[model samples]
Target chain A: MGTKRTLEVELSTTGLSPDGKPQRVPLVVGGDGGAVALEAPPAMEPEFEGEHMLINIGPQHPATHGVLRLVLELDGETVVRCIPHVGYLHCGFEKIGEYRQYNQIVPWTDREDYLNSIGNNCAFALGAERIFGIEITERCKVLRVIAMELSRIASHLVWLGTTCIDIGAFTPFLWSFQERENIYNLLEGWVGARLTTSATRVGGMAADIPDKWLEGLQGFIRTFPKTIDECERMLTKNAIWVGRTVGLGVMSPVEAVNYGLSGPMVRASGVAYDVRKDFPYLDYETYDFDVPVGSAGDVYDRFLVRVEEMRQSIRILDQAVKRLPDGPVNVDDVRIILPPKSKATSEMESMIHHFKNVMEGPRPPAGECYVAVESPKGEKGYYMVSDGTSKPSRWRIRPPSFVNLSAIPKMVEGHLLSDVIAINASIDIVMGEIDR
Target chain B: MSPSFTIVHPGTGSNATPVTPKNVPVSGGPVSPTAEAVGAQFPGVISRTVVSRGETTIIVDGARVHDVILWLHDDAQQSYDYLSDVTAVEHRDLSLPLEVVWHLRSLRYRRFIRVKVLIAKGAPLEVPSVMDIYKGADWLERECYDMFGVKFAGHPDLRRILMWEQYKEGFPLRKDFPLRGRFSRSEQLKNALAANPEARYSMEELSIADAFEELPLDMRRRLSEGEKVGE
Candidate 1:
């Protein structure tokens, strides 16, 4: 067998520095078997070092995943600094929530983080329910748990597919999206909407799962893990995937917590701070599931963490389906829950209750509450303040993507320009949430 | 009724099993232990501690919120290492003071606390920025400033985040700002049309290369004359 020879090319160009000095980086090629490397001159010229080129990516580019614009300062192919600009998709969702009734605001939550719209609905309902001091039925609690877990899997699937596409793996993208479509089918069957499933009301869900919906969910639960296993078989040890992802954007445990990274982003840094476990809600404490933690907080670790989370979500869904209770989906409170449609037309009291519920809306006592949930992205929270009115005095969305994306400049600074895409994909940002 | 779940801070190496709170009161419950600890550490700093909806909100003086938060982060007993959110609340009642809220969490001990500073009506809507404490505050503080016009004093790069740099419609989340916006439809359109798209690239960004020199003389003069093109 012939010996393989490695070619090393160190090609550089000369340009004028900001101070108008001639800056030259001479090209040198290795003749012997050597690896390709970009090497700077031992006695580097100050003018050459000072020549930093600025490039803008997106606000329209595909690699950004959304309308996110990033202005990068590059020294050669390495990123010197990255300044992200968002809000191109800003629609003032929070500002609008202040004017709408609590129930009306649930639909708007769907538009912010569209991938996790059902999870957002649940989080907002939990916050509003806390303020209203309403205890949901046992059936409602288990159903919400099911809804949240299903949406978590769906959101993670989107993240998996889109991130695979970003990193140049097309096969996994198709397989993941195919499974995601299955979950969407189940959601559409339940809520009559897929992408924007405003499935939960303030005190309970909009409606319970229809007849035999559990069968469909059980089918998904039984088959989804095989798809995840197939994805893992394809990409877990693939050289290109590992080369592009591992150790590219490393964040320490302290840095992850300090920067307010949450969900997989924080857990990947070995922080074990899942809101479902640390601050349980919707009977999450009663469920048995493991919060996956990764030692190295890199792009690969984030990928592994998210894939494991999808599996864990399936586990929760399986348990929820088996333990499904039989009862009313909404709270029994007349002030909040609308009267039954069958009774509303027949009874005057039911008609009056329905009229007042729709016209004036149920007013919670004057107070404020912040409810945080373990969203697919991170700790998704909805903060609401009611000044003794049907509408909120202030409505704030503690968007996980917005906080997670803030750490991008720190992660991308010293890496190659191409790694920026990998780091960003790992962040799994939905710009609708960030700009809202 | 009080909250059924207690706010228990676990000891080192011991994990605490937290359950969902049932029957949480509308107001008043078991206050977070940090509230009292913070109140004790900073005697005159904490004005009041309100337990509402099973959450503890310690109202701190506007001037000392940074100090109190710093202590919470540094203290072993109250290791609120994670900053959950930085936002402001503007009430519909115009007479009431605007409130700056910080949601802090301790990953180690599994605790959460809300720190608030009330910026009174007619007073400067400025709060000491926690950007120094939490790097995540960079954009959150900027967004708060953009939406509520609340200034974060020590923030290094507090600028309009969700809004354009030249946005002059006043803060969108403020009580006085109209829902449809300040200007009429035609006027808003005209302003949007007349906006210099070139100015969208900030002066600092343009200075990165020779792009700054390539700008028109009039635009350059206007930018140099302090037209506010990013921080």
Candidate 2:
């Protein structure tokens, strides 16, 4: 390696310099293997030239769906260089988690990936459980499976609705949302919150599932397949949708793996690696469901994979509900989880346990573990290191969106600018999770 | 729960019996030598008293940070190939200024370890970028750079992320930085107005007006009256 040098250069707009005159100023451009200098050249005006035109999509555009902006360098309609500028909704979630207790972080997880709050809750809960070596009850696992599957379906519905809108199909958005509202109702009945479901606790669920809530979920499961069929009938073979997606932004299996792509992105590229199947966590191994993979590796393939996944999630939910045991939802270990509110007021030991757990938190054996689960977006992994403390000494989330979004430049390198929207929608990025 | 067990290496084609619960100890001693080296190489790097657990972390000095990281990654015996994540801890009140941590794992050995580098608040607060060995370090390094302002010397792109453009004044994740939202207008909007002063209405003003028009009549009146919009 050679010694690096820093350079300082000045950039000034041709206008008043606070004194109402065209004055030059200095700008710093630090780099290595370079020189530092400033020179006054002939007063020649600079014009935006060249075939490539710089276009800003938005920090507030309909297609972005959230505060996401993309600066595209386009040669005619073809994208030359694309840069995804994020952080319009940076809440510093991980930093916030540092201050909150282990259980308190559950609510924050919901907001990180609002579309799949249940899955987010599961990931965080499982990570914390692994750290503390807490064994969740079989009933808790079954309930988690049911909730996560429902969340998967709801997430896919939003993806379908918004993706259709992105591709100029309007009616499907409303239709999908109508069905999605039913699933949200089911979620609310159980979690007491629809979108931001802070449902899961460190050792188990925050509470047991009510019978009526389970009944409603069973009803939803029965009716959801037909709704998925209705969605497919509208968009699957539609000439416009087929034309827009069939062969656009294709990525090969090798490239997908190299880029660390997961979920629908890798499935669309013909790899059959789902964390649920490959690395079973939360009793997912007991459930029999297919990991739907695609062959085309195009935007259409991604769309098809998600559509099939919703059906598979329904299958898993059906099995989970049927096998859901009639027993305590939480483990018997009172050291990790809190006692019931009623017990805390009545029993002395329970009160002391709650106080101790809240004040000191569960001291996880000094250890480190990496737990990965299949979230709606992709493989969401939490790599946690604990130093025998209540809080994680180091908690690093390997967000699927961040990894999946990395492949965006590769996906759209040679494609047209318009195709970028299709590619972005296909990736299904939630910037909250990505920026966290 | 039962203590599940397996023999590490059984004699050729011979079946190994599972270790019985009666034979199992309440706790076991540290098993891996690599783990022991982790403690020996940097004695005081970790708190002296070691806990008997699956994972152990060693906090190294910022000056020897690059060497320790390289050893963890490239040492033939250790072979910690995968760089899982890199994040920083902002302890403004700690004796050491700040801590930058890296979690490394070896898929072959089925082992995981943590290496931390501590830096004080000063000019050139830099750590060597592990991006050369682990491609995954690219974003993790950038994130640490963006949030904690911990400079990774060889990182390809060291610009601020998760913050608005031209937001260079402070590292938001630092404990001292207030959690409350900033009240100042964006640099882009301010510069735009400064360039074209005749454009009297600010972007915020226009957005508010548009939002008001879009809302239902009852809601609009409530918002205008300063009642909570969601309520």
Candidate 3:
């Protein structure tokens, strides 16, 4: 009996039992030593059944998307519990914002959500303008709309590319990043910086779009969707992609709202809540676009919603380019908007205004305002409190990724270890925003 | 206002499509009607109602804020189902009270309201946690605690989130703390160099492997003395 058992029995770690014990498979040796018979694994090794294992995935790992560290407790390959540790990149942007002027904080905003720096700059500028009681010109509003949409496209592209790499696809990563580079070239032409483009001021944009910048934008708008189509063709129906993403990290509508999810994260759970549509800032309400929502609230649904959002953003960019009115890019107020460099060099009053604006900064009334925008990740908001000074008393960033990442423990329960990577990628977190 | 444009406000639902607000006054616009409703239902709970830059802010009694928030979340008409943020503000003036703010959004009605609690200087910097109402408050509350040293009484795990658990420097956001940090660069570097790599694994993780007992005695003593990894 012992010789037969030793010859016929083989253990395989393929799956887990309902009770969380590691399931095994046994291969029966051929009766006449000619063929092997598959049989149910025999239960043994009782001591090993209850011993859970602990594993750590990041802090320095590439799959985490950032410096996020996840400690998962496992029963065989099934995740029993997951603990996430963040803030390895904490630089205290909020603390720093308290010491800097409202306009000075724009660059810091660029650093927080580095992937969406221009969008953050627009958000901060909008919040500051509200506090300063300066309504921007129509042209500035249109430019900000363009800036935000372009930033959203860049950010969503990064999410798509990195998530593909995480889920064992390589081609889409290259294609998405190539398009992202085109966006960077456009940004560099406008702001002279790519990753941290501080292209916004309190009253208006830092500079108007250069000659033929619109042509570059038109080129991108015309050709960018093809890349999205190509990536979709590769992964949307791929069996391996579907198997890895579908039905993983599911959150019901009610649960998604309770978790304070926004952007594609909440929209994927069938909630039609969009800050642009609901809260309506930067004239987003006037633009015609659909808010993509998903029914399943799974990773695959999130991917679909994000892809659809890129198309919707293109629609918005098209409308903005067509309707962009001609006017002064900056407000007429000398208190906030600096004088033109050419005028500053010649006119004494303009030079004085420029000196004062740069040195003292614009002082907002003693008040507070909370301005929220539909960032690519979610509802990004800036809460500014002023005490009748150039510097803000308190500057708080309502980072969407931070709140969205909080739901990971609930999402990863009962999932396999490999699914954790997919779920984390689905969160679309930037450590700069989370740790700030 | 033109009849073609539908005004966005509470109780209007989907029939009233929101439009981008133009010329929002710096102060004194229409306040959120929920402020009065909250004030009427929870008498003496709201201390002050302020409408600044077109957003309504209600300062509630610190002890009763949890009840107000729970009611605001559970009520059908005032369903502020989303907890957008949880943050605290320390004023530059030393005499002012610390303000703990909660930003709530009602997706169905398209309304946003800010609820604030003022903790007087020298008073216990603590408030009841709303984690029960919004599970998303877990990290927000923890982050508020980590940055401001404000305690959320009922939070299941109110630990330092961004900063390490054993970080001895005082709350960085406190007005009194220097911008450069509490310690000099050399001292901070010395402390970082002295930290043991094995100590970074939290006791919760170590307990599963039963590896705590095998650690060096001094390290065990440090961990046992309430020094642990991040939350």
For candidate 3, the per-residue lDDT at B76 reads 86
lDDT of 3 by residue, B1-231 (tens): 111111122334547778887888999989899999998999999999999999999999998999999999989889889999999999999899999999998877888999999999999999999999999999999999999999999999888998887778889999999999989999987876555332477767766655666555776788788775534
DockQ of each candidate relative to the true complex = 0.38, 0.08, 0.37
After superposition, the stretches of candidate 2 with alpha carbons farther than 4 Å from their true spots are A1-50, A357-368, A385-394, B1-84, B89-125, B130-136, B174-231
- C-alpha displacement of A349 in model 3, angstroms? 1.2
Q: Of the candidates numbered 1 and 2, which has the greater lDDT value? A: 1
**DockQ of candidate 3 (2 decimals):** 0.37
Q: What stretches of model 1 exceed 4 Å from their correct place?
A: A1-50, B1-15, B196-199, B210-231
Question: TM-score of predicted model 2?
Answer: 0.72
lDDT of 3 by residue, A224-282 (tens): 99999998877775545765786678787889999999899998887888899888888
What TM-score describes the B chain of model 3? Answer: 0.85
Candidate 3 CAPRI assessment class: acceptable
Per-residue CA lDDT of model 2 for A1-436, tens digit only, reads 1111122212321235887877543322332212333121112232444444556687778887676777665656667666666666777786666666688888888888889998889888988877776677789888888888888888888999999889888887898899889988887778788898899988889878776887888788888889889878767655456656756666666556545667888787777757676546766767889987877577877898999999999999989888888888887888988998999999999999999999988777766666677898987877665666677655667788877776676667556777789888888988788876
Give all TM-scores, in the order shown: 0.89, 0.72, 0.89
**lDDT: which candidate is best?**
3
* Interface RMSD for each of the candidates: 11.0, 15.6, 12.3
Every candidate's fraction of true contacts kept comes to 0.65, 0.12, 0.63
Ranking by lDDT: 3, 1, 2
Per-residue lDDT of model 2, residues B1-231, tens digit only: 211112111112223321111211213545445657766766655443222234455667666666666776677667665565677875535454677777665433435566767676674668898877766577777778888778999888766666653454477676666555343558645743433222122232233334446544654675577643210
